[model samples]
Target chain A: MKMLRNLLCSAALASLTATGAMADGHGWSLKKAAAPYAGTTVDVVFLLRPGYEAIEAMLPAFEEETGININIIKHPYENALGEQVRDFVAGGDLDIALIDLVWIGNFAENDWILPLADVQAKYPDAVDPKLDMDDFFPLVLNAFGGWNDTVYGLPFDNYSGLMFYNRCMLEEAGFDGPPATWQELKDVYGPALTKNGKYAFALQSKRNETQSADSFARVLWPFGGSFLDANFKSNLNSAESQAGLKFRQDLMQYMPDGIVAFDHAETVNGFSQGDIAIITEWSAFYSSVVSPDTSKVADCVEIAPEPMGPAGRKPALGGFSLAVASQADEAEQAAAYLFIQWATSKANAREYLERGGVPARQSVYEGDDLEAFKFVPALVESWQDGVPEFRPRFAEWPEITEIVQEWGTKMMLGDVTTEEGATEIGTRMESVLEEAGYYSGEKPLAQ
Target chain B: MRGQVSRKTIFAFVGPAVIGLAAVGIAPLIYAVWTSLHFYNLTKLKKVKFIGFENYSTVLTDEVFWQAMGRTFFLLVTALPLQIILGMSIALVLHQPGLTLIKTLCRLSLVLPMATTYAVVGLLGQVMFNQKFGVMNQLLGGADINWIGDPENAFAMIVFWDVWQWTPFVALVLLAGLTMVPGEVEEAARLETKSKWTVLRYVQMPFLLPGLVAVLILRTADTLKLFDMVFTLTRGGPGSSTEFISLMIQRVGFRGFDQGLASAQAIILLIITIILAQIYIRVFYKEV
Candidate 1:
C-alpha cells in the first residue's frame, strides 16, 4: 500500500510538471496549475458594471476549467466603496475586491490589499511569463494597477472620457461632425443644437464624487488646470481653472433647466432620451448609448475624443482594478490571483471586449479587426491622451472631493461665484491636507 | 421570603434584556464618547490621539455643520406640524362612526406609503419630481418646476416626501387616542355645547392632546435623523440646501473618515434630541 501511494504521488508531480511545460508553450492555462486548489471558492466583491457583467458571464467557463467556484458579490457604483470599507473593517470573507482608482492609496496605505509583486514572488508559477504584462497601456497599468511604486492589482474596465453626440442632431443642426473645441461647443453647436425645445449639452453636476472628481476634473485638466500643483498645493483658484469654471457656467445656459441635480444616470438618460445633443461622458457609457433597450437614439449616437481647451485635449481617465485581499488565506489568494490573470490575459481580451468589456491591453486596441467595434478608434484616441492624475488618488481625496462637490454645486446653483467657490475649495482642501500631515512634512504627498 | 423570591424572579426575567441594552447601546455610546475625545481618522488610524473638546470646537465653528443643523430643524418644524395636522384631519374623518369598509380601505391606503422602504420612496421621488420628464411636471401642465434643482424647492420636496410617508403613522396613533376618548364624554360635551366644533375644541382636542404630543415626539425624533431619503433623492444637494444633521454626521464619519468629528457631532445631536424630548415630556405629560 505504501509503495502504491508513493507511485501515485510521483505520477501527480509528473502531471503537474507536464502541465507547467504545456502552459509555458501555449501562453497560459489555469486547469492544470489550479488542480490543488480545485475546490477552493473565492468570494469577490465588485461594482456592477458592463465589464464586470461580461466577466461574470465568462465565470462559468473558468469554473469548469479550474474547478474553482467564484462567488461574485456585486454592488452599485455609489455604494461599492462604502461596502468595501465596511467589509475590510469587519474582516469579512473577501478573497478579492474591485477597488476604485481613488481608493488605491487608502487600500495600499492601510495594508488592506496584498501587493501583487509579493504574490507573484510567492506563487511564481501562478504567473504566466508569456502573458506579457507590458501589453497593458502603461498609463493605465501604472495609474489604476499600482500604488506607491508597488503593483497591487490588474486593470479592469479602464475608461476615458469621450464626447458622445447625437449624429442626427448634429446633421440637423447643419454640422458635419461633433465640435472639436469647447469654444465651438459653446459658440457654434450650443445654439445650433438647441432646437425644438431640446437642450444642447448635459453634464453630471450632482453634488457627489462623480461630479467633483470625474466630471469636473475632466474639464479642469483640459483648461491647463489641475487639483494640485507640483508642490501638492491647491491650484484650483488659478486663472486657468477659473476660466474653465467660467466656461462651464457659460455652457450651462444651453443645458437642461435643472442641470444642477443631474447625475451620471440623469445625464446619460437625457442623452439616451434625445433630450440632450452632446455629452462628455465616460467611454464605458458607450454600451448604454448603443443598447436599443436603454436608448432612444442608439443608432444616432457617435463618440469622439472630448472637445479641446486652449491648452490641449485631456479627457478624464477613470476605472477600477481587481485586487486580491490581504486578509484572504494563501490558497484563496492564489485562486483570486489566477482569476485576475485569466480575466485580464491577452487571450481573453477580444472575448472580453465582445462581451461588453473595455480591454486594457494595447494589442486589443491595435487589432486589425477593431473596425467591428465602432467606438474603439475614438476610445483609443481618448485613452492615448487621457490624464490619469486629473483627480488626485490620495487617501484624503474623498474628503477633498466632498469640498469640491459642495462648492462646485453652490457655484453652479448661482449661490456662489466661481471665484468664491474656487477660494473655498482651495482653503478647505489645504486645511484637510494639512490635518492629514501633507503640508506639515509629517507624511509625504501621495504619488 | 416572598419579597426576596419575587425580586429574584424579576431579575431572572429581565437579565437578558438588561445585558443586551448594555452591550448594544451603552457600550457603543461609551465608545463613541471616548472616540469623540480623540483625533481618530480611519484612513490615518495610526495617528489617533486624545484631543479633548477639539472635535467639538471644530464642529461648532463649522459653517456647514451649522447649516445642516438649521436645515434639520427647519424640516422638523415644517414637516412635524404638517404631518400632525394632516394626520389629525384623516383620523377625525376615519373616527366618524359609519362607513366601516371605506374607513378600513382608506386607512390601508394611507398606510401604504409608510409600508414602502424610504430608499424606494426616494427613488420614486427622483423620477416623479424630475423637472423635465417627471410625472409632477406632466401633472402640472409641464411647467418645468425644477423641484430638486432649486434650493427652496428641494427643501420643500423633502418635507413633502416625509409628510407623504409618515402622515399615516401619525394618523393611526391619533386614531387610537380618539378611540380611547370615551363616547359618553364626547356625547356629554355635545349635549352641553349643541355644536360639533365646540365639542371638538373643548372635549375631543383635550382628550387627544396626549396623543398629539406623542406623535410630535416620535415625528420630531424621526425627522431629525432623516438620512436615507435625502441620501437617495437629493443627496443633500442643490448646494447642501437640504443637508440635515444626520446626513452631515454620516458625511463626516464615513465620507470624511473623521470618526472623532462624527462622534462629536453625534453627541451634540444626541444632547439636543434628549433636551427636546425632555421638554416635550415635561410640557405634555404634565396633564397625563
Candidate 2:
C-alpha cells in the first residue's frame, strides 16, 4: 500500500512539474518558477450583503469555465475593507476584495488597488460594454469610485439615504401623507405623530460611518453646508450646518432615546416593529422593511424623499465598490476582473435588484421588474437627487467618524453645544488634514 | 530526580512547540512593537519611517484619546459596582434551603446573557430600552422616555447591559465560594447566638475573600476591555459619552489609518491594564 501511494504521489508530482513548466512557457511571469494555479483554490473575500448569495452561487459556473477553483470568504462590510487595506500594505495574499465607495480615495492614494485600465485594455470584450459609464447616476459613482479622474473600483451595490415611514402611523397621526419639508417634519408631523407609546422618528444618531452617511451628511447638504471648502479645509462648522445638527438633536427629543445606541439595525427594527413613525435609512433596507415576515409594519411603510433643510433637499449617498488587489497574481487578477465584470454587469445588476439588491445604474431604476417591487420609484428618485458628501475620503475617516459620533451624540443628548461640537470637529479635522499634508502649519486648508 | 532527561530528548520534546509559540506569539508582538514606532501612513505609499517617540507623544497629547479613556472608565464605574452588588445578592439567594429547582433555574437564567452573542444582546438591549414599545419602558410606564437618545439614558442603558450580562458571572464565582463554607463553622456561629449581620460580615465574607478577589480581577479586566456591548449598544454615542478604548483603537487603526498612533494608544492601554492587574495582585496577596 505504501509503495502504491508513493507511486501515485510521484505521478502527481510529475504532472505538477509539467504544468509549472507549461505555465512559465505560456506567458506567465513570476519572481519564482511559475505554477499554473489551475486547480489551486483561492479565497475571494466577499462582503455578505443581502443579495450576494446568488452571486456566490453563480461562482461555480465560472469555476467550471475557468478550470480554477474558487472559495468565498465572507466578512462584514466595514471589516472586509479594513482587512483588505491591511492585507495590501502587509503584502498578504488576497485574490479578490470588496470595498466601499468612500474607501476609494485612500485606496487609490496609497496605490493599494490594481488599476483596471490594464485589464480593460486586455479584455475589452470580456468586460461588460453595457457598464456605459455614462449610465450610472453621476453622484453615486462619482462619490465612491472616481478619484483623480480614474475609475478605481466597480460599483457593486449602491444606495442613497431615503426617508422610510409608517404610512399607517402618519395617517393615524392625522396626516394624510409624509412630511414634505424639514419644518413640516419637525414642527407639524414630529409633534403630531409622537404619542403615548410611539416616537415620531428613528434616525441614527450613534457615531459611526452610518451616522455620518445616513443622518449627518444627508442633513448637511440640505442646509447648504459641505465638509470642506473648495480647498479641502473643514467647513462642517458653519452656522447653517449647526442649525442642521441642532434640528436633528431637537427632533430626537420626540424620537426614541435609545437612538444613541442605535445603528442601522436598531433604527430599522424600531420602524419595522411599528414603534417609530419614520426613519431616514438606506435604500438597501427597503425590501426587508416591506417584507411581511420580517416586519409587522411592512404594508404600512412608505418611502419618501429625504426632508428638505433650510436650504433645500439633499440626501446622502451610500454604496459599495469592487477593487482588485495590487498583489494578486496574473491569473487571480484576470479572474477578479472577470468576476467584477460579471457581478456588476447590467444584467447581473438587474438580477440583483430583482432579488432586492439596490443597483447603481440609472436604467435599472426604470426596469419593470424593479418598478413592481415596493417603494422602487421613491428609491430611484432619492438616488437621482442624492447629494453625495463623499465621506471626505481621507485616511482619517475612522477618526473623523469618532469625532462626529462623540460630538453628534453629545449634541443629541444635550451634553454639548452645537457650536462647541462643531468647533471641536473642525479643529480636530484641520489637524488631521495638516498631518496628512493637505494643509501646512503656516496656513490651514481653509485659510 | 527524573528531571535530568537526555538533552536531545528534551530538545525533541520542546523544539516544535517553541517554534510554534514564537511563530504565533513572538512574531506578532515584535511586529506590533516595530509598527508602533513608525509613522505607518496608509495614504502616502511610503515605507513606514521610524518616528521614535513621536506617535507616543501624539497619543498622549491627543484630546480624543483622553476622552475615550474617560468614557471607558465611566463605563467601568457604572458597571462594576452594580455587577458586584447584584451578583452578591443573587449569590446570597442561591445559598438558601429547599430552593434547588429555583437555584438551577436561576443559574440557567443568569448564564443566558453570557451565552448570548454581543450583537444580539446589544440589539435586544436597545429593543427593551426603546422609548416607545420597548418592554422596559412599557413595564415602567415610561412610554415617552427615549432610553438611548439622551446622554443620561444612554449611559443608563450601557450600565444596564453591562450589569445584565456580567452580574451572573460574578454571582457564579461568589456562589462557588458560598458552597465552600464549612457546615461546622456556620453551626458554631449559630450556636454562639451570633447576629445574622455579624455572621455575614465576619464569617461569610472572610471566607469569600478569595472568590471576591477572583471576581474583581476578572471583572476589572473585562470591563476595561469592554467593546462589543458598547459598540453594539450605543456605538460610543449621542456623541463621545459612550466611546471606550477598544472602539477608539479601532476608529484610529482602521478608519484613521494611522497604525503607529493606534499602536501607541494600545500600548498605553496595555500598560494601564498591566498596572491595574499588578495593583489587584498586590492588594489580593497583601499580608493583612
Candidate 3:
C-alpha cells in the first residue's frame, strides 16, 4: 500500500507538472497569490458528470493547499439543475453551483447568481486579465456565462455532440466510410441495420436534457427550423421542423424498439453490449465508448462526422458552467469565485482534459495532446458552428421541457403526426413564452 | 377541585402530543390550504402573492388533471371490489384445517408479496408485463401484446399490480375474522343440515362484516393515493391514460413547480377522502 500510494502521488505530480508546463508555454501561468479568504471552508456543489470523477479524485490536493474544505454535492444528471435552482430560490446556503450552461439565463435573470467581475478583478495573476476573455471558444464562453453583456459564470467541462459508428460493421456492409449527407445516410446505410436484433443503431429518446440536446434540437437545426423564431415566438409547428421529426421517426426503423425509454446509460450499455452498430450522442462518452475495458467494439470503433441534413451538419453544445449564488455569504462568495477560477484555469483544464474532460478553451482544442481525443476535430467543428437551441433558458424551462419531452416521446412512438405534435407543442410553447414575457406582439410562427 | 385536578393532568399529558401534531402535520396542512388560495410558482416561491380561488379554477380546468383524477377513480372502483373478493376467497381456503404443509406454504406465499417494497413490486410487474422482453409475452409465444403501452391494457395492468401487491393484506384481514367465527355456531348450523352456501351466507359473512369493512376502508384510502406502482410502471403515460391524482399532485408541485395548483388539488382530494371515510364508517358501524 505504501509503494502504491507513492506511485499514485508521483503520477499526480507528473500530470500537474505537465499541465503547469503547458500553461507556462502558453503564458497563462502565474505565481501563487497572497492567502486571502484564508481558513475559510466553502461548500462547492458539483454535478456528477463523468469527467469530474477525476476532479473528485484530485479534490484532497485542493483542500490541502487552500485549507478550504470543499463539500461536493453530486446530484444525478437529470435533477442537478433543478436541485440547484431550488437551492438558490429557497435561499439555501450554496456557495457555488455547477449549473448547466443553458440554465444560465434563468439563473442570471432571477438574480440567483453573484456577478464574478469584481471577484475576477482582485485575482489578476490567478485569473489573467488578458486570459479573461481570450483563448477560449468565444461562442460557448459568451453564450453560457455572459448575460446582458456581463460575465456571470465560467465554462467548465464542455462537449459538442458527435457520431460514433462500428467501423467493422460498415466495412462488412460494403462501405469504407461514413455517410456525409442526409440522403446518403438514408440510401447507403439505412438498410444495413436491423431493429429486433442486438446489432442495431441507437438514439436517445428519453424525456430529459439529453433528449432536448442530442435528439430533438439537433435534428431541428439541420432542417433550417428552430424551437423559436428570430422574434422568440415558438416555431415548432413549421414544415421544416416536421420534416426533421419525420426523419427521426423513419430512422427508428433501424434502431432499437426500446429507444423511446433509453437514456445515456442505456445507449452506452447498448453499444458496449454489442447491441448497437452506431451512436450519435454527447462527445463526453467518446473515450468510454472507445476504451477497451468498457466496450467490446472498442478496437472496431471510429468517430464519424454528424450526418448531414437539409440545412447542414450542426450538433448541439452539451456542457456545464460555474456560477456563484446570489445568496452566498461574502466569504463563501469569494471562495466560490476562487474555486471557479482554479477549476477552469488553463493548467487545470489541460489536466482535466487529459483525464477525458472536453474543455471550453480553444487552446485546449488546438493543442497537440488532443489528437488522441479521436473525435476532437469533429467536436471542434460542431462546437464552432452548432446552433445551441439551449432549452429556452428561462424560469419556465421546466414547463417548456415537458412540452418537448411529452411531444418528443410521442413523435418517437409514432403515436402522433409530426405536424400535429409540432402544432400542439407550438401552441404550448407560445403560451409559456408569452407568460414569461419573451413573446411580444409579433405574429406567431407558421404552423 | 377534583375536576380541576383531572383537567390539569389531562392537559399536561396531551399538550406535547397536540403541539407535536400542530408543528409537524397541522401546520403543513394549514400552509397547504393557504398556498392553495394563491398562485404559488416555485420559481417565484419567495415572491408568491395571494390570488384567491385562481389555482382551484385552474385545477378544475386542466385536461391532464381531470385525466389523472379519472384514471385514479377507475383504479379505485375496479381494484377495491376485486381485491376484497379475491382476499376473502383466499382467506376462506386458509381457514380450512387439513394439510399443514400446504396451509403453511399458502400463508407464506400470501404474506410474501405484502412484505416486498412497492417500488420493487412495480418493477417486477413491469418486467412481467413488458411487451418485447417479458415472461408474459414469451409465454404467449411473443404475440406482441402491448400490456403496459396501450391505454386499456395499461389500466388493467396497473389494477393487476395493485391487486397482486395488496390482496394478501386483505386476505390477512379476513383471516382474522375467519378465526373469530364461533365454532359452536358453525357446528350448530351444520347439525341443522344447512347447506354450505346457506351457512356461509347466514353465519360466515355476517360475522366477517367488521373485517370486510376494515379491508374496504384501508384499501379505499390506499388505492385513492396510489402513486408508486403507477409512477414506476407507466409514469401515467401514453398520454396520461393511467395518471393517478397523487402523481398529478407531484407533477404540478415538484415538476411543474406550480405549488398552489397542486395544493388546491390536494385539498380537494383530501375533502373527498374524508367524506368517503365518514360514509364508510357510518355504513359499517351502524349497529356498533
Local distance difference test values of all predictions, in order: 0.83, 0.71, 0.73
Worst-scoring 10-residue span by lDDT in model 2 chain B = B279-288
lDDT of 2 at A309: 74
Classify candidate 3 by CAPRI docking class.
Answer: acceptable
Query: What's the count of clashing pairs in each model shown?
Result: 0, 14, 0
- lDDT digits (tens) for residues B1-288 of candidate 3: 666678778889999899999999999999999999987887766557899898889888977677777778888889988988899889888888788899888888988889988878778877888766788889988777777656677788888888988999999888888788899987898788758778777777777888887777778788778887777776666445666899779777877777888899999888888888888888875331
Question: For each of the candidates, what fraction of the native contacts does it recover?
Answer: 0.80, 0.85, 0.11
Which candidate number maximizes TM-score?
1
Identify the superior model by lDDT, candidate 1 or candidate 2.
Answer: 1
Q: What's the DockQ for every one of the candidates? A: 0.76, 0.52, 0.36
Error of 2 at B231 (Å): 3.1
Comparing 1 with 3 on TM-score, the higher-scoring candidate is 1
Point out the worst 10-residue segment of candidate 2 chain A by lDDT: A28-37
Q: What is the lDDT of candidate 2?
A: 0.71
- Deviation of model 3 at A41, angstroms: 3.4
Off by over 4 Å in 1: A1-28, B1-6
